[model samples]
Target: MKRLLIFYFLFFPVFLLSEKRDVYAISDGKGNIKLFWLTSPKNYPSGGWRIEEEKTNKVIEKQLYCGREEFLNALKEEEKGLAKNFIKIFKDDDKEKKGKKFLIVLEAMTNWNFAQAIGIGYEIKDVPKGKVRYKIIGLDESGKKVGPHFLSDFLDSSVETLPPDAPENLKAEIILREVKLSWSQPKEKGVIPSVFFNVERDGKVLNLNPIIPSGEDSSFLDKEPPSLMEVNYFVYGVDVFGRKSIIKKISIYVPDLKGMVPPENFTAEEKSGKIILRWKKVENSSGYIIERSNLSNSLYEILTPKGIQPDMEYYEDSNLQGGSVYYYRIHSYGRDGKIGPPSLVAFAQAKNQTPPPKPKNLKAKVGRTMVQLMWDRVDFPVAGYRIERKAEGKEKWDRLNEKLTPEPNYNDITGLYTQGKFKYRVIAVAYDEKESLPSEEVEVELLDTVSPNPPRITNIESFDGVVKIYFEPSPPEEDVFNFLIVRGVSEEDPGLVIGEPLSKEKREFEDKFVKIGQRYWYRVVAIDKKGNRSDLSSSRDINV
Candidate 1:
């Protein structure tokens, strides 16, 4: 026999009967049943079995077999022979037609045995779709001394073969007002066999009936949350034929709070002439109220106005006395105006108005598109430096930096098209946000003073004692005024001027005063009318 044959009906009574959990049966097609009931009795006449046809009100007799393993194993030869005859007597009566259906009952009576017990069972058939009702007859042996009789609860039997698999991965979470549960559907071959699910809490049925999931949903929320206690939940999938799957279970704890929790991470600092206070916010609060005290322990007063939002975490006290230490404490209130416990005291010193010394040795360099400025760094604990600029003749200096300049050097790269003399000044700002006197002004003139591009020295030749030079002039004559030719004994020496600056119109110059076997190096520079000088050209060498 297969394992399913061995185990499928091994515990069928528990699933089919309303009054007994251990009694079970399996039937052959010809109306013969191999029923198994795990029961025993010491005496013969004291214990028996009863069956009832609920629809016709007919009572039938069922023989109680001594199915104890030891008793069956130890049967003598004659006893075994007698059991064969008893099996014939125990067969169903001919009145029970094979093809007809009837509401039937199976009742067990171990009441007279030393161990008193009684079980009554019922089931709805055609296709079983209901719960199993179970009840113990009695607890004492005297209570079991009754005669055989039919149990009234039996009604039918079912032949359903398949039940859904258990639900997977059950989860539970406790939120503000509800306990949420989620689970995956059972695995099936083609389509879902589930008709609904039954939910339970601590073994008590929660939904009045099986809960039908909305289109393809797998989650449910329990709005009627349990009290402050650990609660267990169970979800069981029930198929269309009322076959139930194994249960998915989870447990969660619900917390009970008496009042609101206090704020956390409170801190205070003096920044930009104001006392800034901040702390982590608490949930479900109306707003936070800040208190200030001049003395360390007394004279605290509320500093915030009413009706502030609950999410605000920072407050600024701009009316603080300069150079004085202010102690602060904060508390959150609910919508009902009930205040929570006050936070730990925090203190900060208001900044003074005295400023640090001004920066010195300011310098400016003007470029085509930008001007770079540098100055001595301040050693005092100042906030930062402020840079301002204006036209040379303008009285008011417009602020150049959007915020305080944190470094000693800054590049004025914002406005470049306005050309002329520009004057700049920098001031040191103290922690109290007081600006010091402006440093000495630095001016830069922005005019077109670029020199013309240089010419190339193409080649040089020396014949006899005279050196002749050839060159190429690239820039227009209107931009270049002249070129200066200088000679050097070696590459590193800046020799005397070979001649006055050469005219732009002249591209080459001949050095006639050269001795035989002497070597010389020569370079030229182009000078424009604005007095701006270009870089030296490529060097040429001559040996005569």
Candidate 2:
């Protein structure tokens, strides 16, 4: 007799992923998927994933991770703890040989109940060029088969992939009553599956579209810029396959009072920290309104909130941000309060009157082996930033970053093995290599943010109705707070923390909690003084 197996699709309807974020999938362009997703808040005892061919409906690979124990046992052990190891993105075939092990990337870094996390997912590689469906299930801890959640994601081998660069130099300028937006056309000209332009306003994309390429540029006009002064525009270049280019954003400022013959010869000159503006007077106008802004990205600030007298032909505007462009315009009005159209826009670059200002809001996040730092962006133009560190009680400061980091954050691994008092400072560097004053020093007393390494089990023995588990200590004996003996039916089960948490000096523990004619597998777990737990040691099984 031939037996048949079947999976009813209707029974698992709730597992269907209705959200795009169920499992984030992106193609590396080399036939592999880069995936990551949020962790469960319910602390499911077992979480699993299954990958199946969409058309053939055949499962290729799957895993049922009962907890940290099973997940750790499946992968290589690392000293950096679970958080860093969990969120790593792999691109090559080397990871495929490991039989699927994921290190815990974060533990203390996230509060599991609130700000949930998505990390340590499958490193699926060398996938065929077609549709692949994946399922992630969260099983309960109470021994009830009830599931807290199930996520089913459908990923095509063609997962929304695109080239790194978006259209270059996106510009938005005021063209009379309309706003003109344009970008450099694709170097290799094409349409549809190649590269085509799409314009989106506020957020809604225009369904009926038309693109006319004129020379090296393609442009679009926001026929109706919602009677607003400042509008944000997101521009994309999508192909026929629906894959999109990196989104370029533009903030366009459309003036309300416009179109009347503006003042002529309106000119602005850079003078230290201020811009000096002068313009020819318009006949029959008694007063004028002066406005200034950063380029054309934002609404202009009215310089003459109380109206400038016609006699004031020139005004000195000193309130400005360092190393930035300032655009200015003037409007003339009659005896009536009605304001006339704005004049020709004049822009000038403001110079750095003094040196760059001090950086602010320097903060640190203590990680397993390193401390990550972040600070607010400097308002002035900077080539990059330099970071310096000094050990507590040390008189000299040591430069930590060899090269100026273009980004505002840095990771300091300097006291990784030992906890100490450390101080850090940051400075801005101009493109000319000139340096700014160092920011206020931030001091941190490093703690044991890292866990101890997994211990190695050498021998196990059973006699007199008791089981003895022996392991070699990996951390300094004094730093170890205790050792836990985990006994389970299966070595992979993160079995109960049995017996008392043993002292640091003991390399072995005896377990008397057992039943006759039963089987048990034992493993060792260690904890450091600061309460960081080590991974479960390799297992050894014995029959009672």
Candidate 3:
């Protein structure tokens, strides 16, 4: 039931170069599986490794080669320069539990430490495609071996041949006697995102190890190829598991010194009103032929009238349907109208070509608290509009709306305190967030009509048979003219303002005029500089 099939190199590299020793598995298309791993240095002192299955506490005997006698006979065919010793499967004195078979491999004697890394290329024949649970544990010696030995976690390896995709668009550029091969990486959807490539010439591998893609392509230079004769080259992708993709083959005849090859680094991209196609200039080429195709893998139509001059390496195709993908391929011609071989196909999609018209009829309505902005909505379809604000003398304009405004209106309240000249502008935005020129700017100075919130009468103290009131001041402190302290005898009574209106800074007052045995509720009111009165504050009663 444990299902974690790490795609070898990407998640955990199949090469256990580090100290961890977990088993990795891969299956051939046939019913055979190869379980491979290197012995960790941490297990060198652990004497040996034992493969135990948790289900039956038994060993899959067919998967392992046991004993010096059996290992020597099996190695008769395999080359052997280094000699290693082996130890017994189990210790004599301590035998609490003993597995039936010697699950330990002959490479199991990790004590001396392997000079060369051990590979488990020995395939387990006739093994099932999935669910092969093998628990490889280091014989515990002290506590150092604990790092590599995953005692609790089972190696529930799902062994199957999930080969990586083959490299795409394999191309060969034949120059005289040399052949240069290039290929784009395959689009892989599995956990394994990348693979090293292998190139073969005439069924012989050119590279000993697999080659990794460098930039846009994986390339190889076959400097020495057969002269004049057509030689076939093959390229394939291989993952860390040693599983390979279907090989892509290309046949090429080495060209002479006078012969020209196709242009290199061919690319296509969408520019203003056209899809631009470009390629590196081919030396000594007379002319170039350009062909375009709307559908991939279909017949192509020559887009050029005669042929593009040798000096020009770029062509712009302006006659295109918007949002349609177009494929282009180009090849160069030598002096004798000898067309060079095989050009790479590149494609690009044309986009919406024109800019949207700028927003119009911008206007601003001034209010004391905020400026209400409005503009004539764009008649053409657009994503939305953006609002930006600027002060009178400031050259930089800051955007007021965080997101595009769906409607043609916005309310801005920021920076209204400073009574200064402000300017507003609206920009029309395209679906791709492309902005049009700013609308005609509108300038306005805000009017003063906002009122300050009422202050709260916090605590009213009655000590020594006298009542005193303490209140908190309301903001904006700059706008408040003064505080109005009101006194009321009952809930329904209209409070009377006491001591003509207190100073703006004053927050408390001693009510010496209150007679003994009198109860009264106190309230506070704030008036802004524009004479706008705030609502009365909640009342607090005092007893004398």
Candidate 4:
């Protein structure tokens, strides 16, 4: 009885383990393997199962999973509970196929939970490659039982190049003004490792760059897309080797925008010679358009340039008539070029303090004894014209007309004898004494003078055989066509003409005809463009 009792205790557990069947091995995608099977109803053990290599007769990985929760926790997060729904509807025909879903033995496998599935996996570093065979042994309160063996076809353990395959089942979920995309990875052999994807919308790339999906589940969220009414999305899978697969496309409709808000807090004020308008910035607005009318309900005309940028909140409308009642309205534009409703109409009466517009097309005519200046009349009412003049190349402008002149033309009699250039400007003065900006300046040349001021000998140094003379040309040097160098022995005697006339710019002359050790007198006279010569310059004596 003692021998029989000991034998019965060990052999009874082996007899129960013999009932467990359908044991199989699966690769966990990592360098790991897993084992699963179903045991007879009400026969599953209290302790978990142990996976063993059938060929080597060695235990590879062991785990204690006595319940469904413990079985799922033993697998990777992505693989956990993946087959639960399929297993719930599993039938005997599911085990007949070559690539089939097998049932795993769970701790809940009472008579009612007979079909409950469970799985456990670990790193396969200890197992050899090729046709891997594994068996599951049920661990009970007694010793573990060596269950029946199942085989899996050859699994290539060597590293390989995995080509990226087309993404599957692309779905876009529309949120307000945005979209969220999710998809499944390609099937087994074509699945890419560490793969990323590029997102395109309506044939245009949307993402700043390509991106890898977060977590093992493939998904991408588009926070801020374009402003289109409908969007078509395309996702392209690309592997680390830059291989691109066919695109996964989906179309979705987004909620239409309510349009940009009209400009707010709009106000206008009369400033120096212009109407200054200001407003608060509008959200999602590309720019603002301003309009104005002389009277309320009158035809309003666009006052701002098209596409005027809204970045600057203030705009100045210049040249507006003073003492005028102006009605103004403004509207904001969206990026799509749709205009929003106009803001509340704002009105302001421009103060009656502005001067008339500046005179245009100013004209100056030189006369024998005076200069006559004329300009286009200002269209509006003006008190009179104010004339200003400045010498050529000079910045200081002196008023030529001491008092306002009723005529648009002015006669400059004071500078009639000055043989140089002078610039003239015209400004209109309002009845209120406000002065308009200066007109485009007009330059006048006073070449009516018949003769230029005589040239003066600046230096009369004598060379070994020549008298080198230097002289400064007279005022209105541009009018001096040439110079006549006169030679004589005394100031009382009129000097004889020297060599050919010297040009106004060529003031220095080398009198090579002069003899050394002789006293000679030199004088110079400037000739004007009219061929008139001036009185002789002061004589200078030089020993040559």
Using all chains and alpha carbons, the TM-scores for the candidates as numbered come to: 0.38, 0.39, 0.33, 0.26
Worst 10 residues of 4 by lDDT: 1-10
For 387-443, candidate 3 gives per-residue lDDT tens digits of: 998988899999988888989999888444557788999988765455678999999
Query: After aligning candidate 3 to the native by TM-score, how far in Å is the CA of 215 from where it should be?
Result: 7.6
Lowest summed lDDT across 10 adjacent residues in model 3 is found at: 108-117
lDDT of each: 0.60, 0.62, 0.64, 0.64
lDDT of 1 by residue, 1-544 (tens): 0111112132222222112323333222232222223322222223344443434434332323223333334444544333333323223344542111111111121111101111222222232333222221212233342442322332123323335566677888754446788886555543224546778986777776455444334677787766457888989876433457778788887543112345789899999878899898877677778888988789788887573567988888888655578999887765556566678999999985456789999999887778899999876667789999999788999988888888898999835344678899999887657677899999888855666677778898998788888776656757778888777888887676777788878978888888889899887777887666777777888777
Pairs clashing in candidate 2? 37-118, 82-104, 82-105, 83-104, 83-105, 83-106, 84-105, 86-105
What is the Cα-based lDDT of residue 341 in candidate 2? 71
Model 4 clashes, total count: 2
Q: How far in Å is the alpha carbon of 191 misplaced in model 1?
A: 12
Write model 2 residue lDDT over 17-132, tens digit each, in one string.
11234444456556776443444322433434444454564654444442345334443344223322332322223656232222221221112211122222444678877766
User: What clash pairs does model 4 have?
Assistant: 32-124, 516-544
Q: For residues 1-544, could you state the per-residue lDDT of candidate 4 as single tens digits?
A: 0011111122122111112234323443344443435444234444556666677867765643433664455444433443343333233344453132222222121111212223322235534444556656666545455432344333433332244566677888754345788887555342433245778876776766555444334777777765546777898876433456677778875432333467779998877766888899875678888999987787889987585686868888875666666888998877677666688888876654546889999999887678889898898767689999999889899998778998888899954356788999999986556788999999978765667788888888876687888899878788799899899977677989988988778878888987678889989998977777888998999887
